[model samples]
Target chain A: MIRRFIRLLLLAALVAAGFAFWMTRAVPLDEDALAGVEGDVENGQRVFTAAGCASCHAAPDTKGDDKLVLAGGQKFPSNFGTFIAPNISPDPTEGIGDWTAAEFASAVMQGVSPEGQHYYPAFPYGAYTKMKKQDLADLWAYMQTLPASDTASQPHDVGFPFNIRRALGGWKLLFMDDNWVLKNAPSEQVTRGRYLVEALAHCGECHTPRNMLGGMDTSRWLAGAPNPSGKGRIPGIAPGAFKWTEGEITYYLETGFTPDFDSVGGHMVAVVENMAELTEGDRQAIAAYLKSVPEQPSE
Target chain B: MKNIVTATVIAGVLAGSAALAQNDGSAQVKARQGQMRVIALNLGVLGGMAQGKIDYDAEAAQNAADSLAGVAMIHQPTLWIEGTSNADREGTKALPAIWEDNADFMTKWDAFVTAANDMQSAAGTGKDALGPAMGGLGDACKACHEKYQQSDD
Candidate 1:
C-alpha cells in the first residue's frame, strides 16, 4: 500500500512538471543571447515623440502630454479590469532603474518582463516588437537620460484568471507576433510610417477591438473599439466614419482637423494634439502608411 | 375716475421696472451670464488638464482650485436666486441632474467648495500642505466630472 501511494505522488509531480514545461515553452525567448544594435539617442527622441510614448505613460501635471518623464499612473479600463500604466522611469526603487538594455529590449519586443513573466498585450509590446533593433536601442538610450523618479508602480486591478501572469504566456503564444514590421515594403516612406505606427506607437491598443480571448483580432486592425476608459465608442480610422482623405489625414496630424471641419473630439483630441507636435514630414509619413493599409473593419 | 387713473399709472411704472430687471438684454443680465460662462470655462480647463493625464504642478493646480472655489461661492447665491434657467442660459455643463437630483449635486458642489477653500488656505501655509490640498481638490473635480460632464473622449 505504501509503494502504491508513493507511485501516485510521483505521477502527480510528473504531471505538474509537464504542465509547467508546456506553459513556459509556449512563449519562447532567447534567455542567454541578445543581438547587438547601435542607435542614435537624438534621432530616437524624435521617434519617441512621433510614437507618442509620453501620451499614455507620463502624467500631465508636468509638461505637455508629449513630455516623457514616464512616471505612469494612467488607468486603462477594460472587461478584464483596470490596467494601471507602469512607471517606466529610471528610478532604481520605483521604476526600471536596474533593468539592462537587453531586458528592456525583450520587454519591448518579446513581451517578457525582467523577471521572466509574460506581460499582457495591454503593454502593446506585440506591436513594439516589430521595431528595428537599432530603433529599440535608441529608445533605450533616450530613456536612460530621464530623471530617476521614485514613484511607486501601481498594481493592476485585474480579475482572477487575468491576474495570473502565467496565463499571459498562452495569450502571447496565440496572438503576440515577434515580427511586427513587414519588410521590403514598396515605398520607403510607407514602410517608415508603418514601423512608427505599428511597432512603436502601438495605436491598435485602443483603436483595435479584441477577440474573446482578449487578444487583438488582426482582421479588424484600427477599425475602432470601445474606449478603454468607459467613455464611448472609439471611432475607426477606416473609410466609414470620416472617410478621411490622405491630405486631410496628413493635415489633421499636423493641425488637428477633419474633412468635415470638425477638430478631433474626446480622447482623439489629445492624440491629435500630440501628433501635431511631430515633424511635418513624419506626420505625412504616418498618414501615408495609414492610407496604404488594407481597409478592414474590426468586427 | 381721476383717482383710479393715478393708481393705474403708478402700477404701470412699477411693473415696467420689474420687467427691466429680468430682461435678457439688460446689462445686469449679461454680466451674470458672462460670470457663469467664465466659471464653466474654468471647470472645462481643469477637466482638460486632468484628462491630459500629466503630473500636476502644486502652484498652478492650487490656483485653479482656488479660482473654482471662489467662483462657486460667489455663484452659489446667484444660482439659488436665479434658479435653473440661469444655469441653462450660461451654457453650463451643469446637467439637469444638478436641479433634478438637487440634493446630490448640491452636496457634491458644497464638498468641492470646501475642498477648494482648504486648498487655498493650505497654499498660504507651505509646500507641506500642498499634497493634501491637491488631493482634496482633485477628488472634488473627479466627483463632479464623473456625474455631471458629458464624456468627451
Candidate 2:
C-alpha cells in the first residue's frame, strides 16, 4: 500500500511539471506573415511617431531634435520592478541593428525575443500586439534610418520570482490579448481611432488598471489606475467620467490646452508632444474614439 | 487711563505682528495662486475667442491680453518662499524644484512674459491673430508647469 501511494504521488508531480512546460512555451509570429513585406520610410516615420517609441526608448530628459535619439536608459519604476529601457538604436553591438524584420516583429507583436525568451509586460507588447504588420515593417525601416547609439541596455531590477523571465510566459499566456476593447466602432473615423488608441498610442497601458499579476484588467478598460509612482491616480478617460467633447479632446491633444485653459501636466506633457506630431484629423479621430469608450469610474 | 490705553495699543500691535508671522508662508502661496487665477480668467476670455466659442470682441480681447501681460510682468519673489512647496505644505501644488531650479523657472517665466507681451500686441488685431499668440502663451505655461507644478488631477 505504501509503494502504490508513492507511485501515484510521483505520477501527479510529473503531470504538473509537463503542464508548466507546455504553458510557458514561447510563441513567435509566423514567418509567412512577414514575407515579401516592404517598408516605406515616410510611412515608417508616421508609425514611429504614433508609437511614441522615443518617448521611453530615448534617453531621459532628451530635448528638441535630440529627442529622436533612441539611446534608451530611462528608468520606469513599477509595482513589479524598475524597468530600464533598452537601447533600440541601430547599433549592431548594443542595439537591435542585427535583428531581422521577422525577429523584430516577433519581439514587438508576441513579446518573444529572438533567443525565445518572454519579456516583461512593462515593455507594453500587449498593446503593440494589435499593431498591423505593415506598420511594424515601416517602423523597422524608419528605425534603421535614425542614428544609432552604442549604449548597452541595463537589466531590470525585479526581485525573486518576478526576475524569472520564464515565468513571464505564463503571465503573457494569461494576459496578452490582441482583441479590440471596442468591438463595434461605428464609423471609419472611430475605427481609425480604435487602431490608434489600442494599437499605436497605447493610451490604455497607463489608463487601464492591472490585476494582481500586473496584466491589464480588460473589463475595466481605460478606467485608470493608481499612478505607479504611488503619489496619485492616473485618471480614467472613459466617456462617463472624462466628459470632454470630441472637439475639446482634439484640441487638448493638439495644443495641450484644456477647455478651462489649464495646460497639460505630468507624463501627459510628453504624450501631447507626440499627439501634436499627428495630423489634425488623426487627433480628431482619437477624440472621437475616446468619446466612444464604455464608461467605468476610475478607482 | 493713559497707561491703560498704551498697554492695549501695545497688545494689539503684538497680536497683529504674531498673526502676520504665522501666516507668512501660506499667504505668499495664496497670493501667487490668486495671481494665477487672474491669469486664468483673462486667458479664458482670449481662449473663447480663439476657439470661436465666443464671438471675438476686440475690446474684451485687448483687455484680457493687457491683464495677462500685467500678471506676467509681476516680479514678487516673496510669493515663493522656501517652505511653501507641496512637500512641506497641504493643498499646494508648488514642487520644491521651483526653489532648486530657480534659474530654469525664471527662464520659463521670461518666456511666458514674452508670450503675454506678444498677446497684448496681437489680441486686438483679429481672432486669426489671437490663436497664434495663445499658442505661444500656452506652450510657455506648459513648459513651466511640467517642471515645477505637481499635477492637480
Candidate 3:
C-alpha cells in the first residue's frame, strides 16, 4: 500500500510540472527579427513621434526639452492594476542600452523580453504587433538617440493569479494577432495611415473596447471605450456616429477643435497635443485612415 | 419685489453660514461646491461657442467668460476652510494635496483667474481668436486638476 501511494504522488508531480511548462511557454521571438532592416535616423524620429513614446516613457511632470529624458516612472492606473513604463533610454545600466535591434523588435512586436518573459499588455504590444519590421527598426534606432537616466521602474501592482507572468501566455493565445485589423487597402495613403493608426500610434489601445479579461474586442474595433480610469466614455469614432468629414477630423487633430467647436478635453488633451506636432500630410493621412476603417455601431 | 426679498434672505443665510464655517465645516464645503458648479456652467457656455456646437454669438461668449472670471476671483480660502480635505470626501473631489500645500494650490487658482481674464478679453474678438483663449482656460483647468483635484474626470 505504501509503494502504490508513493507512485501516485510521483505521477501527480509529473502532471503539475507539465502544466507549468506548458503555461510558461513564450511566443517565439526568432521570427521577424529586424536584423536585416537598415534604420534611417530621420525617419526614425518620425516613428518616435507617431508612437508617442515620450508621453509614456518620459520622466513624470517633465515639460518641453526635458521630455527627451526617458527615465520612465509614469504610472498607468487601469482596471487590472497600475503598470509602470520601463526605462527604454540608451542608459547602459538603467535602460535597454545593452539590447540589440532584434531584441527590441522581439519586445516591440512579439511582447517577449530578451530573457523569454512575456510583457503585460499594458505596454500595448498587442496593437504594436502589427508594426512592420522596418518601421520598428527605425523606431528602435531613434530611441537610441534619446537621453538615458538611472531611475528604476516600479513593479506593477497586479493582484494574485494575474501577477503571475505565465498566465499571460494563455491571454496572449486568445487575443494576440499581428495582422492589421482591416485588410484590402484601396490606396497606398490609406495603407500608410492604417499602419500609423493600428500599429505605430496604437490608437485602438485607448479607443477600442475591452472584454472581461481586458483584451481588445476587435469585433467592435474603434467603436470607443469608457475611460478605464472611470470618468467619461472615449467617444465612438465609428461611421454611424462620427459626423466629421476627413478635413474636419484632420483639423481637430491639428487644432483640437471638433467641427462643432468643442475643444479637446480629458486625457485626450495630451493625444491632441502630440498629434498637432505631426506634419499636415501625416495629420490628413491619419484622418483618411480613420475614415476608411470598417465602422461597427457601438453602445 | 420678490427678487429683492429673496436676495436679502439669501445674503443673510450666506453670512450666517460664513460665520459658522469654523464650527460646521459642511457649510464651507457646500459653498465651495456651489461655486464650482457655477463655474462649470459658465465654462460649458463658452465651450459650446468654441466647439461650434452652438453658433458663435459674441455677446453670449463674453457674458460666459465674464462669469467664469468673476467666479475664479471668489475668496477660495473662505470657501475651502479647514476640515474639508479627503476626510470629508462625501460629495467632493478635492484632494488632500490641496490643503497640504495651500500656497501651490493657490497658484493654480491664480492661473485660472489669469486664463479667465484672458478669455474675457478675447471672447468678443471673434470665434477664431476665442479658440486659443479658450484653450488657455482649459489648460489652466487641467493644471489645477492635475495637482489638486482627484482624477475622477
Highest-scoring model, lDDT? 2
lDDT of 3 by residue, A63-126 (tens): 6778779888888888888888888889888899998887888888778898899999988788
Query: What would the per-residue lDDT of candidate 1 be over residues A1-299, giving only the tens digit for each residue?
Result: 99999999999999998887686543434643345566578977866765667766786434453356788888778888988888888888788989877888778777888787787677877787777777777887888887766778889999888898877877777887765434445698888778767876677777778888888866777788877666456667654453677776876665443443233444454566567767777777877887766676434
Q: Please name the candidate that would achieve the greatest DockQ relative to the true structure.
A: 2
- Model 2 achieves a DockQ score of 0.61
Q: What is the interface RMSD of each candidate, in Å?
A: 8.8, 1.4, 5.3
In candidate 2, which residue pairs clash?
A: none
Q: Individual DockQ of the candidates?
A: 0.06, 0.61, 0.12
Candidate 1, residue A16: CA error in Å?
9.0
In candidate 1 chain B, where is summed lDDT lowest over 10 consecutive residues? B45-54
What TM-score goes with each of the models?
Answer: 0.63, 0.93, 0.74
Tens digit of per-residue lDDT, candidate 2, span A1-299: 99999999999999999999888988887766688889989999999999888888999878777878799998889888899999999999899999889989999998999888998887879999999988999999999999989888999988987998989889988887889999999999999999999999999999988888898888898987888866667878887778789998898898888878878887788888889999999999999899888888634
Better of 1 and 3 by TM-score: 3
Ranking by lDDT: 2, 3, 1
Interface RMSD of 2: 1.4
Point out where model 1 deviates above 4 Å: A1-20, A25-35, A179-185, A240-242, A297-299, B1-153
